[model samples]
Target: MFVVPKPLRLLAALLIVGTTSANEPIKLYMPDAPPLTLHHYVGGHGMVGDVVLTALARIGKLTHIVAEPWPRAQIRVAKGKDMLIIPLSRTPERENIYTWIAPIMELERAFFSLDEPVTSFAQARQRYRRVGVGMGTAQVGILQREGFSNEQIVQLKLGENPAHLLSLGRIDAWFTGIPEALYIWEASAYREQNLRQSPSLASTGLYLACSRDCDAQLVEQLRNAINQLEHEGVSLLLRQAYLPLQPDP
Candidate 1:
């Protein structure tokens, strides 16, 4: 082996021992999108999905991507795997449960009714016949908080499939994020083709919550990277791209 200068040798040793601030590819979990997280037809992507992947790129991390249903993704993060869930709202229960780094995106929850108008959570709680909601979602918690019992709300695995039930008048209203409710409605091949989008009833911010058991250093690195990206204007660029496409009610 060739002899190396002392300074160069020291530099090489530091490079090997020092923690890099660069991004490392980590597994990410996202559920299918209809409204809240929609995949693009052109390249099989959605807004939240794009944000997760692109944010990793911004921080120079290798991105390992995965797509699964919401429940499964939740399970993965709960188990303390090397993963992150995106576009999730911040709630008290969640804070107690998971280690997350977000408010990644903002979302509004609302009702999509079949016959009568249900604007407020108060109205939905009192006048609704039957409501549909995604199981294990923040929307479900909201409806539960409004005093609707388990019997009144139909919990489905995915929010997109609820519109068919809504169209048949089997359910009175669908409780979901505005984007998802609209996605389901527009994708339906049934009645009420002229159904209109409703204004948001409640506004909540989404986040990239990770498991509490993950490496603290990794978590801080990501948080710092995301904050840096925000300061550097990457986050704003993304918002401008996706915000214009949101439904206007």
Candidate 2:
């Protein structure tokens, strides 16, 4: 029988006893949606992003949060890269593609206009030819579903202020989440434009979506922490931080 060297035997024992485990920090990615995730905001981190960080602290795992364009973030998560993308709208087509955590918020999808009220989508189309939408947003699909054609849609950069386009008359209307519209409108040069939100076209849930490579146990732990926040009413209080920004309806 061949005898193994003593140091090699000790190394083997160490490998067996001290192998790298699943407790390392995970990388997280977020898009540039304010009041949620961004490079800069009223808070150094974003609103929901801060909440997520606090929740992760509860679980005591190091997590790195990254900010990139929304499309790139989606692609990273979709390709099964190990990352968590936040405020993703859960859709039927995306249901089975990723792991989901607690919903961060619900976005009311509706139209914001610069001119007279557009009570209906058809009326809006007749009154305004160019409508602005955020690039690669769920609102893109929602608008398409509402029968707005390519010619009528102007795809704007993610996190860009569409109120500018409407104020400049480059685009007559904008379709976006109520919070985002309100946030941008509050700061736009045309804050006095009196941009009105049409009746909610729809409301959708924005959640934390994890890549397939993200460990199931870690995901469960994060989900549990989020659930605890919700149960203890901390989540709602965090959300209420932005409630003061909503325009009177």
Candidate 3:
């Protein structure tokens, strides 16, 4: 029997590992959330997407982004193998469903109303007939946890503008991430109307997450890459470029 030298065996193992990593491309599911992840943005990917892409590049991992409705994107990623989802808010309800790789940014949810701002959930339930929130978003769960009834919560489908709904008096308040609310308000024709933002309802870290059974090695590599970006101030710079006036949380 012929025995391979230890150095030769180590070299062969390295070659095999490199080949596998280089060939396997991860699938990243993203929804169209402006200032975070969107197709029409200047870089063709928003702030969060850019951060994720930059991290993946640092790790030499190829990825293909799948643009889908928010609901479908979450479902597919939750069930699929080795799949990744971005800009996902980490909540107690979703804590066990996915492997949280890294926190991309902090998301502060609030109520944006054309009328008087609702500072508390109790006040909102008593005064507002309906509150608009994006379908399949963390805001929906947050409202539900706050004891908002079905009749009081209006789930806005993809492309449904809460600002427009507010103008038409469809929803009394829009419960959503502050960044998104500000972005929509600034761009919409409803700018003339005073958009009042209530105090933050909930705050959570948005993350790059993977399926429950994600590969541990991949998670470690991505996490390290993301940490390096954070250390170098790359993440902060990107965020500032998009949200210059956004207050630190």
Candidate 3: tens digits of C-alpha lDDT, residues 144-221: 888999999999998988889899998998998888888778888988777888898789999999999899998998
Question: Where does the lowest 10-residue lDDT sum fall in candidate 3?
Answer: 1-10
- Could you tell me how far off, in angstroms, the CA of residue 113 lies in candidate 3 after the best superposition? 0.7
Evaluation by lDDT, superior candidate among 1 and 2: 2
What's the C-alpha lDDT at position 216 in model 1? 82
Per-residue lDDT value at 223 in model 1: 79
- C-alpha lDDT of residue 146 in model 2: 75
Q: What's the lDDT for all of these models?
A: 0.63, 0.70, 0.79
Give candidate 3 misplaced runs (Cα > 4 Å).
1-22, 244-249
Estimate candidate 3's alpha-carbon lDDT, on a 0 to 1 scale.
Answer: 0.79
**lDDT by residue for model 2 (1-249), tens:** 111111212222222211222465666777767655545554434556655655665666566666677788788887866677787889876788788877877878778876555777788767778889888788877778778889898889865668777887888888888777787688678887677778787788888889866777878887988887777766676666554365545
Q: What digit string (tens of lDDT, one per residue) describes model 1 on residues 131-211?
A: 888877888778777788888888887534687887777887877787666656655685345554456777777887777
Best of the candidates, lDDT = 3
lDDT of 2 at 198: 80
Query: On a 0 to 1 TM-score scale, where does candidate 1 land against the true structure?
Result: 0.78
TM-score leaderboard ranking: 3, 2, 1
